[model samples]
Target: MVIEENECILLQHRTDEDNWCIPGGVMEIGETFEETVKRETFEETGLEVNGLELFGIYSGESCFVQ
Candidate 1:
């Protein structure tokens, strides 16, 4: 997440779920992780992001989160 100097984080509101959340989406074919992050972030928030640190990777059939 992008944290400003004031320590406020950037989050997106999900209209369908009626809640606030960290913006993310499924990766596209042939896209690098960085490319996916940049594309998804801009698509969700209309903000461009550069220099992302590798965070946790999670996967499993039961890994669903809301």
Candidate 2:
């Protein structure tokens, strides 16, 4: 999830589910990890990304969230 310049987290309203969620989707073929995030973010929020930094990577997670 990304925090916008206005201090608001970029969230998309899914029409099917009507739930708030950060811009995210499955990565496409031959795309780098950073490219995936950037692509997904823009696709969902219509925001052009300048850069992104990875804080951590979780593997084999058993629901780190909820």
Candidate 3:
């Protein structure tokens, strides 16, 4: 999910690790990609979001999996 305001983007500061990244998480069972985005964004940032659009898709071994 991309949250842009005034040309700035939203990023999450991770508490468990020393890094800043875009807010996201693993998809729950039976959840679509968009649902996962909405759920994770709210879980991480307390924001309720809609009007989702595809930003990109990544695959292959270099992608993170959990």
Which candidate has the top score in TM-score?
3
- Which predicted model would earn the best lDDT? 3
Residue 37, candidate 1: how far off, in angstroms?
Answer: 0.4
TM-score of 1: 0.79
lDDT of each residue in 43-62, candidate 3, tens digit only: 99999988788988665778
Q: Write the per-residue lDDT of candidate 1 for residues 1-66, one digit (tens) a residue.
A: 452437778888999999998888877789988898899989999998886887766567676645
List where candidate 1 sits over 4 angstroms from the true fold.
1-5, 63-66
CA deviation > 4 Å runs, candidate 2: 58-66
Worst lDDT window (10 residues) for model 3?
Answer: 57-66
Predictions ranked by TM-score, top down?
3, 1, 2
Per-candidate RMSD vs. true structure?
2.9, 4.0, 1.6
TM-score of each model, paired residue for residue: 0.79, 0.70, 0.81
| 2 or 3, greater by lDDT | 3
Model 1 pairs in collision: none
Candidate 3 lDDT at 62 equals: 82
Predictions in order: lDDT: 0.79, 0.73, 0.86
